[model samples]
Target: MFRSLCTTALLVPLLIVSTTASANPEVDRMFAEQDANRDGVIDQAQARAEATRVFRALDVNRDDERVIAELDPQIASGSPGGDGFPPDIHVVLRQATMQLRDVDGDGRITRAELQQAFVDGLLKADHDGDGKITRAKLIRMHQGVVSPAR
Candidate 1:
């Protein structure tokens, strides 16, 4: 009887954990969206496409690329009068953009540059050192839960 009670106690927590994780509606929706082929895993192509869509959305100028200037509106919108965000935000974005793009430092953002930028940006946004960035993390960053690491 004691052994059975111990097993029940241990399994109860495990079951609760599994149930809680499975109950997250947002995760379920995201999984459905990302599982384009319904294969239950997001392959590289899907990840890349999702990243590309995000990059394009942030590329306010519709120039097919994101530059430091392109992020101004985003920063501004969050700040008073849309005046602009802290200089630090600009500096980080600028340096990150340059590091991702400007491989040649030629002052022009090319297609390759944009691709690299998206990859790098995705990595930066992925907090908790996890390989994947969940919707919660993205929302937290957007809400400034943590200043983005350049």
Candidate 2:
């Protein structure tokens, strides 16, 4: 009985890890949908354009700047029309801005910075070094939307 219990316990975590190591379909779909030009990749220009649109819509004050505190609630509540933007969109935009800021102290953003940000994000999210993250892994990692280990 002791040996059996130990085996079960070990197996449980393995199952959980396996399940969590996948990408998020909703996120994937959002990316695809937004890549309207369908260039087989969502380039920095596309990302920035989308971000600008979202920022403008949410800024309310039209100050051309968005602070994390001001953005977080709108992001959490789904923004604008409540279904106004994908949650990950906000994350991606914020990450891009941070990367740009880090690379250049001038407070100006560049395409290279945005590209690096996206690449870095992909690398971080691909936790298992599998070169790709399925929808399930993304959801599991970000929101704990997956089932818990037994």
Positional deviation of residue 23's Cα in model 1 after best superposition, in angstroms: 16
Query: lDDT for model 2, on a 0 to 1 scale?
Result: 0.43
lDDT winner among the candidates? Answer: 1
**Where is model 2 more than 4 Å wrong at Cα?**
1-23, 78-150
Summed backbone clashes in each candidate are 0, 8
- TM accuracy, model 2: 0.39
lDDT of each: 0.47, 0.43
Query: Once superposed on the true structure, which residue ranges of model 1 sit more than 4 Å away at CA?
Result: 1-34, 75-85, 101-104, 108-150
What is the Cα root-mean-square deviation between model 2 and the actual structure? 15.2
Please provide, for model 1 over 36-146, each residue's C-alpha lDDT reduced to its tens digit, 9 standing for 90 to 100: 777654444555564454455555567765554554554445445546658897567456545545677766555555555444444443666655555555344434344
TM-score of each: 0.42, 0.39
Summarize candidate 2's per-residue lDDT along 54-83 as a digit string, tens digits.
444554566554444444444334344544
- Which whole-number lDDT from 0 to 100 does residue 115 have in model 1? 50
